[model samples]
Target chain A: MMAAEKDEQILAMIKSGGNPERGYRMLMDAYQLPLYRHIRRMVQSHEDADDVLQNTFLKVFRNIANFEERSSLYTWIFKIASNEAFTFIKKNNRHAAFFDKGENADELESRSVSTSQLNGEQIREMLHVAMEYLPVRQKQVFSLRYFEEMDYRQMSAVLETSEGALKASFHHAVKKIEDFIKSKNLY
Target chain B: MEDLRDELKNIGSRLDPAGKNESWDIPEGYFGEMQNMVLVQLHESKSNRPNVNLRNLRSGLYAVSGIAAMLILAFGIWFFAERSHSIDPAGIQELDQDQVYAYLEENIDEISLDMLMTDKQMESEILFDQPQSEEDWDVLLEDVDLHDLNNIF
Candidate 1:
């Protein structure tokens, strides 16, 4: 079935108070990979990503009843995942004192090689390193807009902020990253 | 705006399929495990509601027991007071002085050997017995010395 048709069927079953298991399973199957990657990028650690991914779905299960049909299920799920990611970041920022020993250039270099076709691995590493320097909100906005390809309207819904503000955050994020790259002569 | 959009697109392309082919695959059976965990929690919540109800019932029983104990205590006191009144109604009545003396006189035979011995014994008896009259008491008081009255009256 088309994704929309499937979503409608799931909603109907959920509303009827029928077993939510099948519906929840369907949602997990459909969105797990994308959601995992999104969290992985946000947290920057595989174990943390795995932990948050499970928490995200657990939240989806518990709160699915409260999901008003005002927005698409896709947007609702993404919003939940994003909130979890931001919560993780806030918790970790207190320990930023421990994490601030300059970026692991070697680790970034290794990871960037996979995407070396478009930009050299070093440049990509430079970009990622610059990303780590951004304020939490800016990094989130930048990742959602650029990597996730979420538009301002969608991002507004996920971030629960105005579209204008999201755009401004993205703008500032891009400027900072570009300046960092140029100053370091990374490209 | 177009330039910025292109730059963002370029960034997006670079970050695409992030961590692809890395060993960061989602653990096996993760979704199933999550579903099971949630189901277990939901079931626990369902059972927990009854435990709360039972706690409320226990407290209610305690309250009823306390009230019953108080009622029993109150009834015990009332029962004892009522039984005492039923057994001794005349004892509860007020008595005049003459009535008190009459009662004592009526019981005099039982109270002493002198009263039991009779008139012959009374003629030989030397123990003083006063008459129950105010005039005799005053005459007796006049014959006695003031010091003797102080000692004997």
Candidate 2:
């Protein structure tokens, strides 16, 4: 079934006066993976992503009554998830204090990467480090475009930006990431 | 996805799949457990919430009573303000000379000679304000001696 049709059924079930829990579970089952992956990419930590995703779900549950479904249900959920991820990043203060010293990158690697392949781990670390240098909005644009594979129209809905501005931001973010990789001699 | 990759290709960039070779690991059955975790958290939060109708009724009562109290306070202030203005100063300002005399006669027992002396100035005029007009002065000076005027000066 199409996601839109599924979403309509789920909305009906939840808005029905009986057995809203079933609807909520269905909603989570449909969205949890994509939402988790998006949040994980933005926050770069499993624990933080977990918190953000759970918080996102909690907000969705609380505010579903207010969700007018003006945008697609998926877009609405993504918007909440994006906002929660940004809130986590802003509250942590670690994302801002990352300098050329690579202290936070090393720390993030130790906490997040527990792999045997050191080369892939280093490349992932380099990517995260480069992403860290991006401004918050630009990084969000890049993550939504690149990692989440969100088109500009859907992204425009979730980010509340014009398609032109989002396209420009994504382009700048990619260029910046490419430059960072080149400067680090990791390209 | 094709369009995005194509656009990037036009930009001469190789951001293929955004590090597809480097994948993040998740706990086993994470998505499976996610629904249960979220449901548990939701139920716990809902249980912890105050009763919605009761909370709304309480806030409504508070808001209505607050508005009533503000109105009563405002009315009380306006009533007292109006009464104070109309009772004392307006009553006196509207009174005539005869009414003033009548009031003084009625309240004379409440007043003392010292209090009366404190108001040395005559009513409707100051006693020493060149007490007479120029006509009176001219008439008095017409009957006065030059030496008397010099002595007064």
Candidate 3:
């Protein structure tokens, strides 16, 4: 089926208070991996990312009744996932060491770490380390824009901020990451 | 440079696929475990609802118990009062009068016996000044004489 038709059918089922499992499963099947990757980048740990992903889906399930259809279902789910990620970070801000060490160790130990892969991991590590220097909202905007390739309007819906402000945040974040990468001699 | 940007964007796109078809291996019966967890939470919520209802019922029972106790107390008081009244009717009447007089004496701050005596004396003087006619005397004698006939009983 086409995207529009599928969305309409999902909306109709939701409106009729039908089994939420079907709709939720559909949503999970469609957006789980992208959201998982997005959360993984933000949180930088596989375990934490998994937890946040589950929580995001649970939140989406619980709050699907209030979805106003103002944005695409994709955007709505991303918004929920983003909020859950921020909340997780805020609650576990004291555990910053956990994020850094785990990502580094996991990247180094993985069997995929060839010389080329090492270069990619190095760049990823530099970006991840520089991400710590940026403000939380800026990091989120930067990741979504540059890494996730989300447009400004979609990000505005997710972050509940103006597009202009998102643009500025992305600009600042990119500059900070670039400076950090240059200073560290990371390509 | 534009080509590099496009290439970078393409690489970024590949970084996170919309549908990766990647599946993680879980322990056996992971879905069952998850389903069990959900069921446990559902049961908790369901059970908690009844507990709240029971709490409300307990409160209602307490209210009913209070009303019943009050009714029993009222009935006991009424029963005791009636028993006392039946035991000594004349004594109770006298006790009621004494209670009334004691209540008035305790509550009334500025009572004057002098005014009460003066009112009684004035009424007596009026009675003494009234003429005693023969017809009035005859009626009085008749009232007293008729009671003498009751001495036979």
Candidate 4:
């Protein structure tokens, strides 16, 4: 089905309140994979990403009544997921402190590459570790832009920032990540 | 924008030149199991919601009933107060003849109209009760003979 039509159908089913499980399941099936991948890129741990993803969906279900449909459902759901990610990270002070004291990428690469099955996987890990050095918003912007390849307009809706600001943040994030990879000689 | 794009392209080319490789792994049956887990939580949360609202509803009912009881009590007091205030002290009703005769027979010695009043009040009121208004005078006049009034005067 077309995206707009799918959204309307899901909303109608939920609002009808006759069979909620169908609507909720449909919503889950449609958004889960992309949201999971996005969250995984942020936290870099499968377990944490799963937890965040669950929290995001639970919130969406609980607050389904308040959804105004002002933005596209895609933007609305992603915005919830993004906020959940940041909140989870903020609440885990130990994790926050670890990221605060930036990891040594060279050491991380040397230790992690031995266990990694492929050079590509190791490079991705290195990239994830390098991402830890970025400020939180920049890292989020970079993940949405570089990894997810979302345009500034859609991102603006999700992040609730101006398109110009998102573009600027994405640009700055790219520069920072490029500098980090070069500095570490990960390439 | 162009410069940032170039930088991103360079990073992408150097790091993941062939982008077809999958780097992440998941345990078997994770996605299939996750739907059930989330749905269970959703059901649990929604089910728990009505209990809180029921508690609130109980308290609200109690408050309404309490206010109703207070209103009833207040109205009762005001009604009784107005009823008692409406009675005029001097405007006593004509007693039943049997009740009056029975009381007179029981307390014949103690119930002298003379002992209960001064002679002057008896002369002015003609041995019934004080005539405080024109209605009382009229009632007394209706019960007395013209010869008795001439004798009293």
What residue pairs clash in candidate 4, if any at all?
none
Q: How good is chain A of candidate 4, measured by TM-score?
A: 0.85
Model 1: how far residue A125 lies from native, Å: 5.0
Model 3 lDDT, residue B101, Cα: 85
Put down candidate 3 lDDT per residue, A1-187, tens digits, no spaces: 9866787677666567676556655666567667877776677666677677777866666677788898988888889888998899779872233224433434433432234434444445545666656666776886687666788788999999998898777666666656655564434
lDDT per residue, candidate 1, A34-133, as tens digits? 7887776567666677667777877777787888879888788889999998898678652121125223434664565445354544454556666666
Q: Which segments of model 4 are wrong by more than 4 Å?
A: A94-108, A111-118, B1-22, B51-153
The fnat scores of all predictions, in order, read 0.07, 0.37, 0.00, 0.32
Evaluate model 3: give its lDDT: 0.65
DockQ of each: 0.09, 0.25, 0.06, 0.17
Best by TM-score: 2
B26-124 in candidate 2: lDDT tens per residue?
899877677788889888988998876978899999999999999999999999989889779456667799988887899998976555554544443
Comparison by TM-score, 1 against 3, better one: 1
**Ranking of all predicted structures according to lDDT, beginning with the best and ending with the worst:** 2, 4, 1, 3
Question: Candidate 2 — which pairs collide?
Answer: none
Candidate with more favorable, higher lDDT: 1 or 4: 4
Tell me chain A's TM-score in each of the predictions.
0.81, 0.84, 0.80, 0.85
Question: Sorted by DockQ, highest first, which candidate order results?
Answer: 2, 4, 1, 3
Clashing pairs in 1: none
